[model samples]
Target: MRKLAALTTLALFGLSGAALAQEVTLRAVTSFAEKTTYSRGFERFIERVNETGKGIIRINYIGGPKAMPPFEVGNALKNGVVDIANVTGAFYTNVMPEADAWKLRQVPMAEVRKNGGFDYMAAIYAQKMNAIFLANFVGDNPFHLYLNKKITGPDMAGLKLRITPVYRDFFQAQGATVVQTAPGEVYTALERGVVDGYGWPITGIFDLGWHEKTKYRVDPGFYTAEVSALVNKTTWDKLTPQQKAILQKAGEEAEKEGVAEFAKLNAEDTEKQAKAGIEAIKFDAANTKLFLDKAYEAGWAGIIRQSPEHGPKLRGFFSKAN
Candidate 1:
């Protein structure tokens, strides 16, 4: 009787361990600071997952470089160090050179949001990266010229402008000396007069306090930046069908909330920037048309010549959306 009791106890303990192993907790990382719009969306995603996951699955967010650098997020996810990450599509251009084709193409946010482009991109990302694309949030803030001195038109020929690769050629073509600088270093560069201006997302200027060093803001509305949230394939595969369903439902909820939040915050921030005394320059009709035409021509032509395979699909997607 004592031997039978011992065996039954061991069996029950083993079953308990097995049951505990089935409940999973996932880690997600992102490069956005806690105050940034991206972080807000991430918070919403986490809330949705927790509310609907029924305690079977949990997601713990690790924000910014404190967890992992923006560029390293993909590698972290793949290695199982982190189960998910949020990243800008532009940052992964090195891994998928064809990614630049998607970033550079000028597609109106409204049209892209209405069409099935987000779903299509999600599918492509999943197939290529062996991860589930959770959401594609539209960043509406345009890359603007933040200058130290007020200048009209593109004739400020000698101005040294700090820019990323996407805008490097465009700025050079406009007669500005281009200086490549990371987002974090822009303020010091501007204060020290290493560059006359920096081309950046308008929100970044405010977020990083670069607005304190600059006076003018130009709204050329050149192109939009694409940001995405992805989950690891291994982690996703391990999820039960019920868990997967919960995550998918949460992702869709986050998408709607994110789009609305971004739109509202963008408008409010623009107003705040204006009130803070930063001069806002809206390109006149002629300049707007000229800028868009030249930008599209240079951007698309360069992508097709460089990444022929993915370039055509990217062009088709943008063209249809436009």
Candidate 2:
């Protein structure tokens, strides 16, 4: 009688362990702080996933470098330190040379979002990173010029400007001395005269307080920043067909909300910037044409020349999307 009782308890313990092992927990990491619109969108995605997943899959979010740096998120996801991550493809140009293709086309974010460019990019990402593509969020606006002093088209000649790698060629082509600074150091660099001007997304000027130190902004909006959220391939493959369908549906809903929110917030913030006393210059038609002509030529040429191997494929994608 005692042996039979012990056997029954052992059987129950084994069943409980098996059930617990089946529960899936996903860890997601991002470099953006929780307050940023990008991070907020991600949170909404997590909420949708949780609701749709029905407790079979749980996502645990870890935001910002306080958890991991933006650049490191890719490796973290790749190594399984985090099951998923939000990463900027441009940052990984060195690791994946073809990434430069993203910067090549001067395509508008709205066009890309509406025309399946995001899906195309997702396919490339999946092939290169061994990850499952989920969703992409376009920032509020395009990158523009912020100067510490008054500057116009011709006046921009010989100005020292701080820029990221992708924008370096664009600035250099415009006759500015390009200085590379880490994103976190831009504000201090501007204050210290380390750079006379900076080029970044318009919304970032207000977010990072660069507007306070900058006196002029050019409205020749150049490029949009694209942010992507992805999950580990191995983990994604483990999901049931129904589970995948639910997550994909949640992603589509999240994308719609995000795109709408971004458009609304961008208009509001543009007005706020004007109220904040920075002069916003709208380039005249001639200037606009000149800028676009020069930018497209320089941007596309640089990418093709620098990354000839992947340039054809990228151009094909951009041509179809554009």
Candidate 3:
């Protein structure tokens, strides 16, 4: 009788352990194609999470644009169609216009987290988008103008270029005729002369072979790329404390790794682009000042225009304190 009772208790304990070990999978999507470093960093983040989490949490990464349009993924996350998303500020701005402040972030991601900026932005994200702000994977590598021909003077006269929200206003201020083309279409557009140039991160042009059509990179890159990860609030609230800690640790590690990796890739790829005949066009001192000044102004102008009441306060946190 004693032996049978002990065996029954052991069986119950085994069943309980199995139940606790059940895998928790989260579905995720990205705006970038798998070929892009944005998605590569994303994959690394997931790998770290799974390794440390040990089956407590697993993210099932869904396809990119094929799974959902780049602009639509944020909405999908909000509606619980996906638990997480790797999205860009350009698309996320549609859901939370204040997200544009990310473009104006003067400090590093780690610094932002340390300085209370991360939590401040996260609150706005939760309030406005009903989502959790994870981390900025595409860090520090600023956006630059890519052109087929060298840009002369401060003016972008007679240039028709592709633009993302990060630079659309700034490019327009320089007198360029801006064309909005999807990333997948940029190579074809440039090859066939649908557009003369485009603005993109200093890295990742080779992933889509855009560097083949692009010949010159304008110096003094502006605005961080603003690539970020997000989680659905409902999904976030459901996570166990341990599970949440795993994800946050993974995100923090990925954020630091991304900045270092991008710095290396930026130098190596820029050298390669130079070897392949892509020239770095440097503006004269006066034009350089004007270009940078206009870039910052245009970025802030858009933010304030979209959210007059909150823009100044939001920008204050990202910017140097007065």
Candidate 4:
């Protein structure tokens, strides 16, 4: 009788522990497909959290753009259609025009946190989009222009470029007619002559097979590109304090790994693009300076125009001038 009671008691305790481990499960989505560079950061973050969170929490990933349009993700987070998302600010500028200022970030996210930049963005997201600004997953990789048609200098005359909000004003200022196309559609756009080129970081051309159509990469790349993780405020509030801490800590770990690996990949990508038949287009030093200055100038002009109150305030956090 004593042995029977002990066995029953142990079984119940084991069942109780199992139930306690699964306290919450949150759904996550990325703006791009899972196997792509843009999704790498979020993938690592999810890995860390799932490992560390074992019984406490589990993130249910629902896949990417095919699951939902990239541009709709910001609204999805705002409206609570999903608990978490990985996306670039450029894709969701409608949620916060001040977001454009992030592309201008000249510092790593670790420094941004120490300087209170992260706190400020967190507050902004809470108030404006009903989301929590989670860790910045990847950044500091500058964007270069990939073109089928060549230009000897900064002049982009007679070019039609596919623009993300990251480079709309800058590209337009340089005499290019800009079109917006979804990532999956860009290949068709280029093939169909809807765009002569597109703006992208050094790393993704081969990933999307754009190198097949790309003939040149403009040197002296422009503004930094970044991807960030966010959690819906409602979902965030529902998590236990311990669960929140696990997520926060995992995000930091993932970002550190992501940034370092991304830097290494950027170097390899440039080399790979060259071997894949993409040429490096360049201009003299004088022309290079002229080009970069025009880019940053028009970039800030458009940002401040759209977000008069916060754009200037953000320059301190996001720019070298700060």
lDDT of each: 0.69, 0.69, 0.83, 0.86
Clashes of each: 0, 0, 0, 1
Least accurate stretch of 10 residues (summed lDDT) in model 1?
93-102
Per-residue alpha-carbon lDDT of candidate 1 for residues 209-270, written as tens digits (9 for 90 to 100): 87788888777756666566778888899898888888878777766665566677668877
* Model 4 lDDT tens row, 209-310: 888888999998988888889999999998988899999999877778777887888899989988998999988999999999998899999988998877
Write candidate 3's Cα lDDT for 162-228 as tens digits: 9867777788888899987668789899989988899898888888888778889898787877777
Better of 1 and 3 by lDDT: 3
Ranked by lDDT, the better of candidates 2 and 4 is 4
In model 2, state the lDDT of residue 54: 65
Model 4 scores a C-alpha lDDT of 0.86
C-alpha RMSD (angstroms) for model 3: 3.9
Measured on C-alpha atoms, candidate 1 has an lDDT of 0.69
Better of 3 and 4 by lDDT: 4
Instruction: Mark the regions of model 2 whose C-alpha exceeds 4 Å error after superposition.
Output: 1-11, 14-21, 103-120, 319-322
Question: Which stretches of candidate 1 lie above 4 Å from their native place?
Answer: 1-10, 14-21, 101-124, 320-322
Candidate 4 runs further than 4 Å off: 1-22
